[model samples]
Target: MIVQQRAYQHPHQPSEVRLVVYETAAAARRVEGMPDDAGYLVTEEWRGAGKVIKTLGFFPDRTPALDVLSARAQELEGQLYRPVAPAA
Candidate 1:
């Protein structure tokens, strides 16, 4: 289930990025030897090079998910993440 959706504008480039926070759960039935990757899913999308998708992380709860989104917004605004290396 989706909890929140946020859009951010790039400070340097004329581009917009969309963020989605959603909750996911493991299936009741067994899927063999699969990892139980169940939790809040944070995804980012931008219209560059045919729609790029980046998974921020799998948070345990809503607060941390939103916190990440907030920090990402700040980073996009050139107030943070300037010193960080470029994402792969």
Candidate 2:
């Protein structure tokens, strides 16, 4: 399930990408350095019928995660990624 999510519009394209933090049954096996207690994940995804496009990395904490997203978000939006609710 999605624990956190944000969206960004492509400055030149007709699509948006989401920066998401989520949990899954096999979260531990997807990446190395993922602490057993983190229980959360971040990925680079393509929009679809709720499918992940790729695994970026794992984070034990969120601060650094935001930093990574922030940099990418700034390029398109000139600010941090805007928070958005996950689709149900």
Candidate 3:
């Protein structure tokens, strides 16, 4: 099973973070297969034990994915993150 949570912030909130969890590759794959608006997908594998288990998908970039999550965060009590353009 996968669970999503909002990242914590204090003092001055810089950006918002949303957690998308998955237990199996199939689940992660489903999320990956989701539309491009689901943010950039970064997979992190657990290798502490001899057997490899669990893969996590992190949508860190501010893309369509961020837009979708940002809305959800706002509704679910998540911090807001606005992406700024780099200075030339």
Say which candidate scores most in TM-score: 1
Number of the candidate with higher lDDT, 2 or 3 = 2
In model 3, where do residues sit more than 4 Å from their true spots? Answer: 1-39, 42-62, 78-88
Give the per-residue lDDT of model 1 (tens digit) for 2-75.
78777665456544577778887866335454336676778787754567888897777779988997777677
lDDT of each model, Cα atoms only?
Answer: 0.68, 0.59, 0.37
Query: What's the alpha carbon RMSD for model 3?
Result: 11.7
Give lDDT: candidate 1, residue 66.
89
Worst 10 residues of 2 by lDDT: 79-88
Residue-level lDDT of model 3, residues 1-88, one tens digit each, is: 3333334232355433333332233234544445434335432222222323232344544354445544554643533333333222
Model 1, CA-based lDDT? 0.68
TM-score of 3: 0.25
Clashing pairs in 3: 37-65, 38-65, 39-65
Q: List pairs with backbone clashes in candidate 1.
A: none
On lDDT, the candidate that comes out on top is 1
Report how far off residue 82 is in candidate 3 (Å).
Answer: 17
